[model samples]
Target: MVTTSTSVRSKSCLGPPSDMSPCGNWKVSIVTSDLPNAGTSSQIYIILYGQHRSSAPIYLYGTDRAPFQDGHEDIFTITVGDIGTLFKIRIGHTNSGLSPSWCCKEIQLWNMNSGKQFYIPVQRWMARDQEDGEICREFPILNKGQPILPVTVYEVHVATGELWNSGTVANVYISIYGEKGDTGSRQLFRSKNSFNFLRGQTDTFFLEAVHLGDLYKIIVGHDGLGPGNGWFLDDIVIRDPTTNREYAFFCHRWLDQEEDDGKIVRELYARDNSIIFARQKLEHNRKETWAAESWKFMKGNTLQFYNRLTGGFVRLHPDGTIDATGEKMDKYGFFDVIVSKGNICIFQSHEIRHLSLALDNGCVTGMASGRASTELRVVYQPNRCALLESVLVPGHTVIFDRHGKIASESAAGYADLSKEFVVFVKGMFLNNAVILLATSLCQALCLQPDGSCTGVGNQSEKSYWRVHKISSGICMFESVKNARMYLRIKDGQCDGTGTGDIDCHFKIKKNLENASVSLESTKSPGLFVGLQADGQAKPVIYTKNGNVFFYPRVIKCWHRVALLHNKMGMPSVSGALKRNR
Candidate 1:
């Protein structure tokens, strides 16, 4: 936690005492420390209370046009004309803390005449947002000493699951806190500008340079207010520059200053860096890949290599190709991700086998290729939930997963670049096969067993419902508040139930004309589900399905959307991306 300040004058301590010396008029050359990532340019000025022999000390401010930045530059040369001894000199800012305040880690004062230099170490205080109660975070700065692991802030993700409609801020900025020498802690780095964010979207934040093992506080905040202002955070990915080791920090909830339930900031422990998928590649040797109804194209920023020869999208596929025509089951696409030791494997539930191909021989023959290894180098993406995995091929390279893999701009792939903002940040890997949520028309409010959104005894937390797609247009609503319960059709009546039996499955038919969804009971076919104006859902017929208009909304993450496919069309549940919001 950042400590409160006490000094009325912006206080600071100086190093190496020096006696008052006089040659000509003492020339004070002050050099300010440069922090390039420390937000916008700030007008830094030193104030000196000039004391006369008798009268009250006069104040003088100094700083020429040259602003303070990440370099050694003479901010000003004060002409403290020969006098007994001027009062104390302190640093202050022209603008408030909203902007990056002027800060110097090390300040060198040179007496031009005597060529004597005095150095002062001032850590932190780059921008004091806490004083204004800005949404900030306080954590420790890790890895201070030699074998320091240079870690990087990869990206920020938020689960816009139902309740969090936080369009909270137009832009959010980040700052890093670190300790310097004897100085307790200060702002080590600040984002140059605010990053654009949407309430339930994954925003790629300004990459922050950091250290591992040491506690470092990161403050992600916005200076705006009003509708769509509550920010919910999902997770953050930190990467080791040297080994490309990624640590995933999963925070699945609301993070708002106004939140009474809880704060949005979290200190996520870094997972082992052993699972690195960055330099590896998951190659698909299967032909007619997309022909599998389970296979759909994922959206994101990774290269998707198409084997035009077989019209198959490489990356994720079943052990062997099969038609998904007669199954009313979870789309055979999503792979139940299994993390093993330092490696990972994709378990194909439908195939009842792990996805494997292109072994030591780099060929697609089950005969000669001994047995495909389940071991793979799981390189995590910036968001950390997804992987850019590669098979355990001796010297081969390339990586992939869901959150679609559009080739890097250069098309040279991972080898041609170090860092870049690809397509989508994170996604649910349907066995790397591109699985989508099978239900839609968008949004549903959770209903307590009594048809009340307010939980038993009026608990608010039990109100939101999370829709999990099971099959074609069929979904099960899980309680956002009560994990044990799910929206179900009990004895042909609408109610909340604990078990996910066939009665809980509802066929979500899209009424495009009405711009809503139709939930026809899968078990008791003729009856429909309806929601009352008071927000209660009940079993009803097509005529009374009026209030069934409680459309479930889909959440998407976006820093900026670059839709490669420009045209819009009706989305069908036959094959689509899984709904995880």
Candidate 2:
């Protein structure tokens, strides 16, 4: 049982006298529990008691970033006198704020100088209305040997269906439940995508919590506010980055007070079909690498968009108009999907030399190239045509009327093949392999020990690289020889290496209808990792032929083993220049 205390200790006698030596800094991590009214807005303080000396009350406060949130971990550092062998700690809060009750899960402390760690478990409520009504609590040192739960940042993808007023401006909140536990309801405030909760839009968000194991269900709702509070939720996909596992929940319903069930909240369960579809989607993407083809090649390529509703193909005209009237794949129905950048695609009409399909003020029309409205979100799926969603107009997708003419581009609807676009071409795959410049296939890109990146002629172990996914469509290439070094784009150059972090991640975009890939730095969006004719690596602005083509060389496991063995004094092929084929 936890020792409850109500006595207030005077601050004058809490610390060592002014003439003593400091005991060094301590890193403290406090974990809040997932209990009702567990987060406190009041000022919190803690006093450490040791066998030799005690510490003054240290206020647990930091910058404007709020801490002590429910089901969250807060870290702080404090310096005190020689407090040898910590035995107990007195922790409390000034009873303030609307809800002053707090539930502490545990407190972990690490002596920075000595490298000693101490854990104190306090799974109790220190509130006035409950648990003996004590505002202060004392926890003694207990070697419970319990491991703390690892925190994970979960990727959440929320899709709004194409329907009348399917989007809401109300504050949305979601809670995920799994076999282990549940993530407390967190507000879906900031979205990686622009403007959250819009009709026909899919917003991506990140929620950090203790690992909840395999997710089973989720509760999603909104605080019914704003002009249009009714929202039509299409579906949700949550991915655990650590295991690369995804949980899919299909909620083809309305979360509105005036809708079908007149409810503003809903609980959706994970479905097997959704999970399979997600996996298949990933697999299909992995199999196909994208690159921008030459204008000559792209102009000759014929792409088709099958309109399911009209049972026809999207046809283009010389007057820069688009219609879904082609009964079969013909010259008028042929187009080319040009991959611009990170999921942004352009559909260039083969019938019209400079005309491209675009979202024109909520209407699907033909437009000239270089227009911002021409950029669309064309999602590639397995065994199916690609889905075309508007990037300029958020959730709107391309659709055609029964008469075959282009309908509204702002349709809030579920994915349908009739509303899908497709283009088949030879692509590249560079997930995890040895990278070689297309011009110099013998030289392999490597991250050196001296924090420099360049292309080496020998395909040694240092030339191998592993791709680590940072976020959706973003990844970092880490050196297989030394995990700490990564191929990084910095200061407009890819000639330097860095410790794989957010700064090192690159937005990988595939060129449509080609066999090469572009690595655009997440830090500097337009800067790409480029190669020179002499096999040198650097950052460059992407162009048609600035030495950006890279070919992936598949190295067998046995080959790596043989190289290691040869290096370990076996009959070695020293000075032998092994060229990558």
Candidate 3:
């Protein structure tokens, strides 16, 4: 119990009275501003021993002055003490008999008891979102493509899951289904809390999974009693543990701006004038334009479009002339174009070729003989020779001659006796030189130095060589090595007259040997020359329709010759000489 005391003193000290206990404990004195009046009475009140009725009370004692109120002037000693076992103090009130109202200026309670004070500190409570704090939500899936681990899931509502009501759902229960023909049923997770309708309280559910397939579908449903019991899904996030990066598939919706809406509305501008305007603007602003395909710099300052599939350059210029310097451009399978100084150059295989305008020069001049040459040629020939003219086209086969005249000259056609044209000559003939010439029917003709020609008559039909005229008297003839000749003679008398009759004859010259002979096939019908080699003998004469007798040993001391020809019909000796060099 708690106690208090009050006391008052006068300006003058009063003498102590003798009416006190032997201990000399107290001499109560009262001090008043005036003498006691008959209508007003002053009393001194003291609390000797007291107990608090309901609570501890404080006692006050003071001297009362004249102008003071009824309870202000009388001097008294006040002390508070607890009498009862309970820790408390009480105040006393008394009525006076001398006056209509009794006034006690000072009051005191003597002998006060003390009590122990007890107190408790006040406490406050508040709540906040988990994410709003330092804590973050745990990602569910782990090693999605690998083996799965045991999983624990918790359900949460989207509205309350986020600290800011980000309207996001975290770890919410989701039902997933497998693809078609799946043998297993869909799996489900549940929420941890339920909503209260009366208090309008709501709860969120959190879901977790150990592993997810490459493809899966999720189904959501509501279990609450609210009108809209559907799942509240907002921002769904995925996180990779290895990288610790969070990814979201959803983005916040934004209002469409007027410019964006106009662009959308004009999406079909590609077919309208707006697209043309946009393209013009884009081109004007663009620094450069890229070529669609590879190109090469051809002759006459022209860019050639290279065709990768064909391994050729498409001539962009009208003339389609590929320059000799840029011929290496064909090596590249693809190429691009570069512009410099307002001129186009093709960049291919790390090489650059400047383009130039194509000239209308009729033909490419100064081309070496027997090499490929192209020129523009105007063909003018007789109607009979027009067959050759029709075969040539400008920029391809028909080209201007060395005289700068457009000529219809080609080495490929048959020789024409009536016209002159530039011919792509591959071979030439020299005077007094022996050369093998093949006829239109592929028969080989051996032209002699004397302008006379001899051949095995139509070997394709097995026709043997029948000499019609041999110089009158014995004329010396040398047989070529590895060459054979067959001759048939006509019956004739000593008078230089002959009866026309022929027979088959064949002969072969032995290898590595040359033979000489002076003979005439028209001399006798039975004239036969048999040259034998390699154990094989050939009869020089055989009766075709009739036969007559002739001297058998007239051609003594003469041997046949054998000739070996190569694929080109040139003598094997010539081919061996060429290879030896």
Candidate 4:
């Protein structure tokens, strides 16, 4: 927790910290976008902010090898003091190099003092000619928010048949489709295969796209223009970098103008369950190998079990209850692997009670005194679980149905939005305001002396909003400090009303990739609360207005509050571990 003091300094806390001032060491990791020529040679500077104080703009420098290069992650550490509860930061570069623009993918900051990490997704370009033409950007910390859909870099390996005239130079194009979406047709312009596609050769190319979840099939073809465009593709294997899962599409048939089906394009489906069974067999073998060496480093050492299916940490409670809902490494989230007399391994929580985790009748729970389940597998390095690389605050699974109704993971014994969440609003004129409500007459909901709403620079009791989730994804913003006020849209106009009626209800559709959110009026389907030219909230036609998007960045303290609630609800266990069983 960041300490708040009456006196704060607005300066950089460089060098070592003294005993007089409170200091925090932050490890900042940044990833540049993979777009062509997205790197920047200009000097970058960042200013950190806490609840109150702000840090001086510190120049960011990297080794002479290369910094801010395309598709690369760079790490740096800085020491600062007096800034409490880091909330926001301003990052930009001095436009002075040959290619000064930069497309940043995201940033991760770790506080050594709190052992807490924050992720800031910035899939935007900071350039003079790019979208909105804004160089500097401010992003608040994301805590207990929607999971950002990762941009997965897929490794596409195309294998040519080991037969005559099996290679094609007619500009082969490929497209992959999965459950969530599809990557548009892309040409195999560049390949790791030296001479591109050739007979009996395996050419590898990289394709970057939004994660498509479970791949189903792929379309591969050639232009069929060259003299010998006939090609016999043996198979195509694609590896998703995010999950390390590979999908194989077999195609033993020839894709030629006058061969087989005489087609230039062919669709191939993913292999059936045999491959999955084989992979599972391999995974079991690997786990057994690890169990063989478990005696060396498994006994009496604190560790956490990561669920392979759901990206969550396994947590055991003091009262012999367990769940797989933890998102960080904490006291309750740690456990000891107890190897008994018969070489059987038991999972014991790192608590005074020493509860054992076990599975019984398809349910996973912690028992005070019973036979622990040895069915638990140890994946030393689970796919995408890079240990604190992208750890987020623990949050309940939230899903939006096709009808825009929100659904919580309640079947798994998880609660929905039960607590008041704090968010800083961005987009339009109310750029960094804490209050999301604004009157059609006023820019923001500022209570004046006359008891009327007006626009003001200073925030008051009326500025704070409490997200009151009435239904799954449907919520009404109520004033936190002043309970009488609720953000309402009446007759297609935005305003604050004392009455919390149906007009206040809004259907929230949050983007899985970033903090951008859209609010639609439940009463008026196509009517949305969009921003006017001056940044005031207004009800605009959802189809006509593009400014209906807004970013609500969750504050870090909310994570602490959520963590506390999670700790208090330790008596109940989660059914998420059933997949492992």
Candidate 5:
């Protein structure tokens, strides 16, 4: 977690504080807004209150008050000792000062020991009902621990083809292999030999693997068939649900029978893996500017907009209002799943989970959240899950479904990844993940299993990947197929064989507006991750000249599409696996 304490000094007061001593082991800093109503030279004393009613409240600043500037937000931080666990703050103008009132825009507190700062904003302070003049509001509960992001699992499907059941054996068993093993290939589809059965329909069999490259070869074996004991097959089909790529094999005869006047041992062949997904990297500074504070997504960032409710999102509509109707994205439709402060934020990602945009009104309002809710059923629609804020819990933990009306009746909600990229990478310290794209020569970039790297792509099993995580949604590609090589830029392209391999590490910053990501090579300084017009999945050649800021290799990054079918994993050895194909 990046914090400001390391970079900016705490308690940067030009004038001396009225009180000379520090109170607790923590520090509190308050910054005022620069609006017109903001008091420029107002005098106000900050007081901290303890949980016990009998305990006297401590004045944050001694008798001397904090001076505020009219047009600029002012900063006032205090160091305190062990205050009670439960606390609140009271802001009041000096009794004798010229009645120029002040508004507290934002306040930040620092844990002196840990150097971690927490923030709070005061919209419009109100006075106490009692005779005493005091404006106060309790601080929000602090969020603790690292946030958890969503995890996505892709699907791999294999369908059987037409085969002539000429032999006596009616069923055949098929096993797939990326690399050969002594105990035969790993069986993905074990056949049931029933004569002339399952000849016409596409018998779909889902397979799972740690690496997709592990599936390159398929072996067809028969339990009992006469001489020439093989089945005359038509063709086999293989598809990746996530990447949306399909590999088709045209097998016209049995394993031994002639098919182009030769044998047909290979039942399936997919030739498109060589073709790399050519998405150009994005260029930020030239095209646009990003404010880090505004970009930093925090909880309680609410958006009251328009739209028709879908499963977990809203469709653009002319009529819109603030009502809890369905799920909506953060401000934009970018992040699918994000974790912040031990909370999980899930959005209705473009990639469909179970989309049904029917019978929904257009107007609705709701707060954006990164916290997951307790399980509940949809009141209006009992079949679906819910994500409403829990009224029962004082902390307001979120319920399972966004559209769910009743809190106690929905299924438990979980986070799902929205955008995904197939990448090859390895970790770099603060620089982030290193990529494994092609070099000027166009060879595949890779990381050797021995902690080294190469710039060649022929090692299919070692060079492919599916990247889903990054600090700012700007993820780098790593070779899961290869020995886990991270991609980087050497000169213009990354050379896995470079002297300081870490130098090739790059930070991909996503442009949520255009739905694109730009790669800034940390080593090359200003140079971005560029692509050669003719270089699709070939040798990476040359980058034109001195770092062109505007021309820093900009290309459209990822495309949002519905994953027709996913959820690929190891098949269980239970009754579910034994069901008829």
Candidate 6:
């Protein structure tokens, strides 16, 4: 714990010691009193020892006065390294004609430990209230030690009677304090006549070579008053030296309402470790312009364009062609399409139903068939592909063709028929899991652990059905009855449940030339499928579960093929068929 004590003294000068001779040093003195006139000026001098041997004597004084006014006294303080040096003090007129009647009250000397030594013949002075001012014989001395650390000083004025000035300057008076770790001594660094002229609201006074173990205390008194009130005294601060880092604190204020009487205060932290404070002001209106011009591209016209940012996923028009430089649709989605005939179309992830396309404009108007349910008259356009009315049916399949036809259809039994094409069963299997088969003509066959194949030639065998492992697992079978396609389980495997019941998945081999397949199961289940392909895995149409499917790469012209089936129809083939043919 740290402690401090303040002693106020009234003195005229620090007199010389009785037995000691005056060495070559200087001394300073300060006196406080109330003056009679407002514009009166007084002169005080700091006497110097060995004045006859040295050059001209330098004199200084100390006082607390209103910085802006002319009548108040002036105060000065001088610092010296050696205490053995001697000094003297006296009072004289700056300009003889302008000198005011001044009085010298008492004389005292302050030592390194705040000890006081007095001079005889104590002087007296008239106080500000016209009363006899007491001559204090004691002076306080502040000691400077070692272990020098950083310091902060806050100077505050105590309000005695009423509030003072009312402008920004009146709020400048602040209290000074030190954090726990500063070891240097705090003393009167300077006593300027105009404290208001200081540049900042807070000023930093520095001391070097502070001793390692000593408590630092801040002495606060009246610096200089504003225009309204004179000088006064308040409180002081003493803090122990610490080794911790220092951070800054700030406060902000704003008016609460229309009246000035109400205000709000907020505190904010710095964004970065080093940044302390920042302020910004924004305007109400600012114009923003996009660089690219809006091209007058038609709705059905397909053009190709690339986004400079993301390089994936090319956009296509409703007519199954790439759309570039197209006008943005009604701010809802992009381009608007109108249906010409009572056809089917798929938009986004849903399918439309009863879909009748307008012959002139290609606007689709009809009731949409949802997943497992149906809805009222929904309007859509083949060009825009926007669903004007949609009633969502959870977990049900909704299909839409490119011609604007929408319907809800069952995907269970059709899974067999879907094997002939690249089937995309949106809502068939568990979410995030879908089964795509190359062909339905390739019969679905199961392999036993004994390396035996069953259900090879039978299409209506009940045992050749696709069975899932407890609703969460999907069973995938390769339909290449006589061709070899490399099969490898990328993740999850089937268990040895010959019932083909397992809670895992498998994958086809990446390179078909090896004629070797690998299997991994989520629960390690047995899987069986026929393999029949030449050294080169060329695309071909095969039968699986009595359905016909073809791998598009088998044909040189068609590079890829995908079969899509939803509730409405085969909308997946709409765009691809238009492109390939």
Model 2 residue 342 CA deviation in Å: 42
Instruction: Give the Cα error of residue 236 in candidate 1, in Å.
Output: 1.8
lDDT score, candidate 3, position 492: 22
Clashing residue pairs in candidate 2 (N, C-alpha, C atoms within 3 angstroms): 162-412, 162-413, 200-395, 290-511, 291-511, 292-511, 303-335, 307-418, 308-418
Candidate 5: where are CA atoms >4 Å away?
1-265, 268-445, 449-488, 491-493, 497-502, 505-581
Winner of 1 and 6 under TM-score: 1
**All models: lDDT?**
0.38, 0.66, 0.24, 0.59, 0.34, 0.25
TM-score of each: 0.32, 0.32, 0.15, 0.26, 0.21, 0.19
Error of 3 at 412 (Å): 25
Q: RMSD for all candidates, in order, please.
A: 18.0, 23.2, 48.3, 29.1, 34.9, 30.2
* Model 6 global lDDT (CA atoms, 0 to 1): 0.25
Candidate 1 stretches with Cα past 4 Å from truth are: 1-107, 110-167, 177-195, 207-217, 240-247, 257-581
Q: Write candidate 6's Cα lDDT for 283-368 as tens digits.
A: 10000000000111221212222221121112333343321222222111132222212222222211221222221112222223
Give the top-scoring candidate (TM-score).
1
Worst 10 residues of 1 by lDDT: 281-290
User: Clashes in each model (backbone N, CA, C under 3 Å)?
Assistant: 58, 9, 45, 2, 59, 89
- Tens digit per residue, CA lDDT, model 2, 1-581: 21221222334343554432454567788888878668888788887766666677777774545567688787776776676777667677887888888988988888777888888878877776775555666655655664344557889999986443567899899989876556656678678767898766899987765566789999999999997777879789999987788888878678989767899999998863665866754664433422211221242234566655566677778877778767554777767765455567787877676888888877778889769888887665432345677898887777765667666633434332246543433212234433332322234566666666665434567677666666667877777777667878876667546777666888877543233467788888888887653345788888876356454443432334355668687643332434322
TM-score-best of 3 and 5: 5
Task: Residues 207-261, candidate 1: write the lDDT tens digits.
Answer: 4333323323445444445554656554455443544544454444456666546
lDDT ranking from best candidate downward:
2, 4, 1, 5, 6, 3
Task: Report the lDDT tens digits of candidate 5 across residue range 468-564.
Answer: 3445534445555443345556644443333335554556543322222355765555666543321222123223331111101101112111111
Candidate 4 vs candidate 5, TM-score winner: 4
User: Could you tell me the TM-score of candidate 3?
Assistant: 0.15
